[model samples]
Target: MTAAPHRPPGAPTADGTEIEGRLDEAVRAVRAPDAVFALSQDGRRTVRCGGTAPPPPVPRDRLRYELGSASKPYTGLLLAELVRSGVVCGADPAVVHLGPGRPHPRRSAITLTHLITHTSGLPPLPRDFYRQGLPHWSTNPYAGYPAERVVRAFLRSRPAHRPGTRWRYSNFGASVLGHALAAATATPWEELLTERILEPLGLAATALAPAGRPDTDATGHRADGTTPVPPLLIGGFQAAGAVRATPHDLLSFLEAHLRPDGTPLDGALRTVQRPVLRRGLGHRHVHTLTWFRHPTDHGPMYFHAGATSGQQAFLGFRPDTATALAAVSTRRHTGRDAFVATAYGLLASLPPLDRE
Candidate 1:
């Protein structure tokens, strides 16, 4: 790992050239066809783009990138907003909104809190996920599993462990939470998210994939970084991994989390960052309602990342420095993919800038 770049004291922010250099370096390291990097610090924001992909006629900043499971935080925020509005509570059982008489395996034991926190003891995907997804596993694994199927599976499937007794990252749990929230509010999952989180945060460019603005969306690539892949169409797992946004909008979302004093979601923003559970050996790591939390010498850092069939994205921020970052690439993530590592290293090593 390289040392954090030293910023000259009193420097307002990293200049454009410096930011461009960082972006270009990562683009080369990962050999991404298209990449964008956005930074927000102490009310100042900058975005840089570099890659070999043929630039669209429109400005690069206008292009949207898929944000796989990174969308979970937004779902978490929606839950918090609903809770603050008294439409639902974290302690409420999943069955409360999952339609009565379905007879969930966990019944009242699996609460919304458990679902969002990844402690619901649910598996990573539905039992039939492989059976249904195998045909289109590479292109669109979740295409066939509709919301109705997901809910039904949950009611009939048995949990390996008791609710809230384990810490397993479950896409299935996230999907169920989205549907439950929708049921409680009597709205569709997309509408509930748009009304509660996206609209309030002014994330106009952020929307579920395959439905975003077509004119300027970024084309995703296979691991080869050349072959194009269709947009991922996650039927029922929308909450688990279906969000996308331009680099600018993604950065804006993280900035709101860093500094959310008077915003409509101030309370909810703070709520998502509160430590909700501890996992890992000796419980050394931390997880908030929405984000993965890690302590640093400067302060705590919150971050989430995601990957689709042909694209990958990372979102993170350091509250102490009022620094937030959004990184996106057209190439899919692989074991050797340096996109995630480079993006994360950049965030972890950003100089603690002036918070004024």
Candidate 2:
């Protein structure tokens, strides 16, 4: 963590070297092969520090990192879009999109809200998902688990709790939600996401598949920082954790949450910010979409973190402070990784510069 926040040559910053130093320490502590950290306040001043994987080449703001579970918030945003568009109400049953038919066990009970809030009572994944993925294990666990299995598990499985009865983080629920949204909109899950959220937000660099983004690639890496790790391919669980994007794109997305406009999705964007569940005593410690809120002395910060086989990511924004932060790296975690800790630490340390 000794390296100063080394801003890439041409990248500019309004923040002092101390701010860059705070961010620099984290990137060093994590020893990421490739990484990016950016902070914005008052929607104007922005500063970024990047870490390169090996040598001569440097990490750029546009270098894509697998967003993993952080992508879930985007899924949540899409859910809000569907609700605002009248495709399905928050409380409507998932069966609503399955069309007219005798719904499978508990299928009629799961709602879009349940899926987004991770309270649908579904398991983390389908039963056979591992059977299909294990063979690919350290390779691409998700490659064989395709759209068919996602639909199969979602419809056939029975929920442990009546919809909305309990809160459990279920990748299966998020995955099913993606397909359900696609069904309602008559589009594929990826296409629906791109049209509704990515394109509108101008996250042009994000991609569901490696082939989709051909210009560059940041393959996931092991803790050693050299052994390449295969990406967690997007099978049917497109809504779960299969998206990748650059720090520049994520900051733009975060900026939108802080300062909304009179766009087509303003209503949906607003919905994504408001909390619905009482997860803790403070107003900020609730869940909205896939974002979890944490109260800071400065303000409440809404954020989420994600991990793939070889990548880790964090996305957080504090509305009361109008500050947003993001960090990503090719190096993955094993238990309590430094990257995750430093991200949360930075968020805690950054009291809105203009809050006074």
Candidate 3:
């Protein structure tokens, strides 16, 4: 495989060079294979850096990168739509939607809101999930597993804690939510996302296909820096981290979330972004139905990150300023503090919000 072409690193025009240089240095320090960073305010005054990837052949608008957990917000958005349509309630017991196959005595107490907030006491991933013998950090463990296997495993698994007692990231919880969404809508999960979310928002490049559905996609890289791996095919886990999208497409989605008045899912987007829980140390921060929120000098900021076998991606926005940032890296880097810092640094360079 060849590298994607390199775009000049700097501001949108002449004034952005300083901020662009900072982004370039940060991205370089992580040794990312390919990256794209952009900061925007009032839908203008944007600065962009880096190419899709280095040299071989990056598609023009289709630099597909696995969305990883970044796919969470999209799932959250779908749930929010369901909420708006009255198909499901954020605080309703998940068991009601999941049916009787699984003995979730406590499941009836866990709400869709708790799952999205990561407070359902579900572990980050299934305990036996690693027993399949895939590499610990393999970019695509679920590539070979089917949804039936996942459902069966989950049906017999025990909850780690009582519902809503505490917060624990749960890939299983998200997957379960996806299953419930499909069951309620009576449509395939991918098709529901396309019809209700992606298509409506004009996210033509975003989808749940693994190995990406031809055209737009970022190739996965191995930890050792071997040649890029084939696009990941994470079957049943698509709802957890299987999306492939570009920074531009993601930003449009973020804009719609931050400013929903004229968007396709206007009211639903607003409901999803509203704070529902206190998270992080000392509960100093707040979390919405799907997005994490932090207080900024300007106002509250919302964001999320994603990681797969060989890729990492981030998305964030400040509603008060109408500013947002989205980034993607072709190589894996688990330490996300640096990515968050880079995002904040980029946002700081933008014009401050006119209010608040």
Residue 101 miss distance in model 2 (angstroms)? 8.1
Error of 2 at 261 (Å): 2.3
Candidate with more favorable, higher lDDT: 1 or 2: 1
Model 2 alpha-carbon drift over 4 Å, by segment: 1-15, 45-52, 55-58, 99-105, 212-215, 280-285, 354-356
lDDT of 3 at 44: 52
Lowest lDDT sum, 10 consecutive residues, model 3, at: 1-10
lDDT of 1 at 49: 80
Error of 1 at 52 (Å): 2.6
How many collisions per candidate?
Answer: 0, 1, 10
TM-score of each: 0.92, 0.89, 0.86
The Cα local distance difference test for each model comes to: 0.84, 0.77, 0.71
Residue 214 lDDT in model 3?
37
Task: Report the number of the highest-TM-score candidate.
Answer: 1
Q: Per-residue lDDT for 1-356 in model 1, tens only?
A: 12343344564455556766776677677778888888887767778787777876577778888899999999999999899989999999888889644555674588999998888888999888898898887688898999999998877667788898888999999999999999998998888899899999999988885654447678888888889888889999998998988888998899888877878999899899999888888887999999998876557889998998888999999876677989888888889888888888888777654333
lDDT of 2 by residue, 82-177 (tens): 788887788878878854245555667788889889888888888888877778766567777888678877767878887777788888888888
lDDT of 3 by residue, 116-156 (tens): 77877777777777776267446567766677666665666
Error of 1 at 13 (Å): 8.2
Which residue pairs in candidate 1 have backbone atoms (N, alpha carbon, C) closer than 3 angstroms, thus clashing? none
